[model samples]
Target: MGRGWRGAAARRTCNPRGPCCRVAGDARRPSRPRLSRSLSRRLTVPETLPSVPWRGPRHGRRVGTDPRRGPQRRRFVTLAALLALTVSALSASAPFDLASSGSDVAVEVPDPAPVATPEPEPEVEAPLVVPAATPVRVLIPAIGVDAPIEVYTDAMVAAADGWIDPTTHDVVSWWQGGGTPSSDPDNTVYLYGHVSRLEAVFNYLHSVVPGTEVTVVTEAGEIVYVVQEVLEPVGKEALPDDPRINAQVPGRLVLIGCYREPDQGRRRTTHNIVVIAHQVDSAK
Candidate 1:
């Protein structure tokens, strides 16, 4: 063997997989040797490198970081912390309000003026006296009654029922003691007619409805009246003493007739029918 081969062979030992060997008395692979303290100081970097603070771990896992990246990583973390603190302080200060922000500003307003009112005027009075007129004719178109009216004075005697006998049954009698035909509310006009005698004027006076129109003609003008009520049949014997028949109601017209009913295919007078009417104000 050559001298170099003999020297290499003496220093080496073999493993089962290949011709591999380690240095004598060495426990691990060889690395570059560390320098002595005195020499390390002289060989270090001239500029100082910042270092990151040591925190144990992230969550439960160990955090591995390179010491060479300390300066950049520490600067970035400090800036982020300062930004977060500024945001939290601003949010916690006060509620946002637009009106409160401008509370120091001033505004002006003007007042309203006064108003005036006017006074009222006075009223005048009118007269109540109505001119007099005597009733000459009576017209009731509802029961077909158009008859000439005649005055019944002390010369004529009335029956027990206050009925005066006219020259003919077709003629109607008006009591002179009763009211004259005008729009006077203080006067009442009483008219009477025969029902059982021939040519009777008020034979159908009981059939007159409450709204039938009755017109009384006089030398002055015509006075209109509206039927108010047709009183139920009263006893013929009780006419003079009956308060309803003798009532002195002003502006009223009361007509009296015999109340007849069907008896054996003919009409027989048994009671009296009284019709009450009110003067209309337009003719007054």
Candidate 2:
């Protein structure tokens, strides 16, 4: 038995074509691990990973948040303010019309009332009457004689010296002697003064000529006279008595003075120069 067992064992140990040999060959075969291609591709890790900052927010994280939107909002606000100010200025300066025909009426201006004036009073007049009698003042411009007329009297003739008769001073010679009428209606008013004496008041009377002016100022009015004639008699026979020298003639004056001789104090008795003048008008 032993021998037969020994032979079987040897056969088992050295067999190339038996079931035991096949089992040994299976044990020496390479094991093929299950290769999972899908899982290996899914789990792969990159050699260089992209770097990212690990901080608060990512660069492109929020939706619709552009950086330029704030300045654009400020610009839109400024434009709106400018437009509002322009509209306010235009509304404040609007024009207006002031005509009366429209619903907007104008104020009325009334006409001024007429003014009244007062009347003036009338003037009164004085009554007509003769003024008081005042002595006539005679002015003989040629002889430089300006003296008051004096009535014929002894005292007045004494005052005039022997050139005139003391009692018959200022009286014409024709009026002195009673032969001539005392006063005639149509004759000249004669006045007489001595001219022959050296100091006679009428010393220059002979120089008076026609057309010489004489002024007679009296209380009533002034009378202007113009010389019309100058008379000088030749001799005592020519000294005829006449009432015409004593008359109250209108508009006439007669002046008489004695003629002088060559010898002193020897007067020509009859010859005289007479100045005749006419009255013109009243004084101013």
The lDDT for every candidate, in the order shown, is 0.76, 0.56
Model 1 residue 68 distance off true place after TM-score fit, in angstroms: 69
- Candidate 1's TM-score reads 0.50
Model 1 lowest lDDT segment of ten? 97-106
> What's every prediction's RMSD, in angstroms?
17.1, 26.8
The segments of candidate 1 whose C-alpha lies over 4 angstroms from its true place after superposition are 1-130, 158-163, 264-268, 282-284
Q: How many clashing pairs per prediction, in order? A: 0, 0
In model 2, which regions exceed 4 Å deviation? 1-134, 153-187, 234-248
Model 1 residue 270 CA deviation in Å? 3.9
lDDT of 1 at 34: 82
Q: Please provide, for model 2 over 101-192, each residue's C-alpha lDDT reduced to its tens digit, 9 standing for 90 to 100.
A: 34233446588887877666676453223232332556778767766554454455456562344132232232221111111113454456
- lDDT accuracy of residue 109 in candidate 2: 57
Q: After TM-score superposition, what is the CA distance of residue 219 in candidate 1 from its true location, in Å?
A: 1.7
163-219, model 1: which lDDT tens digit per residue? 566767888888888788764546788888888645589889989989999988876
| Candidate 2 structure, TM-score to reference | 0.40
Whole-model lDDT, candidate 2? 0.56
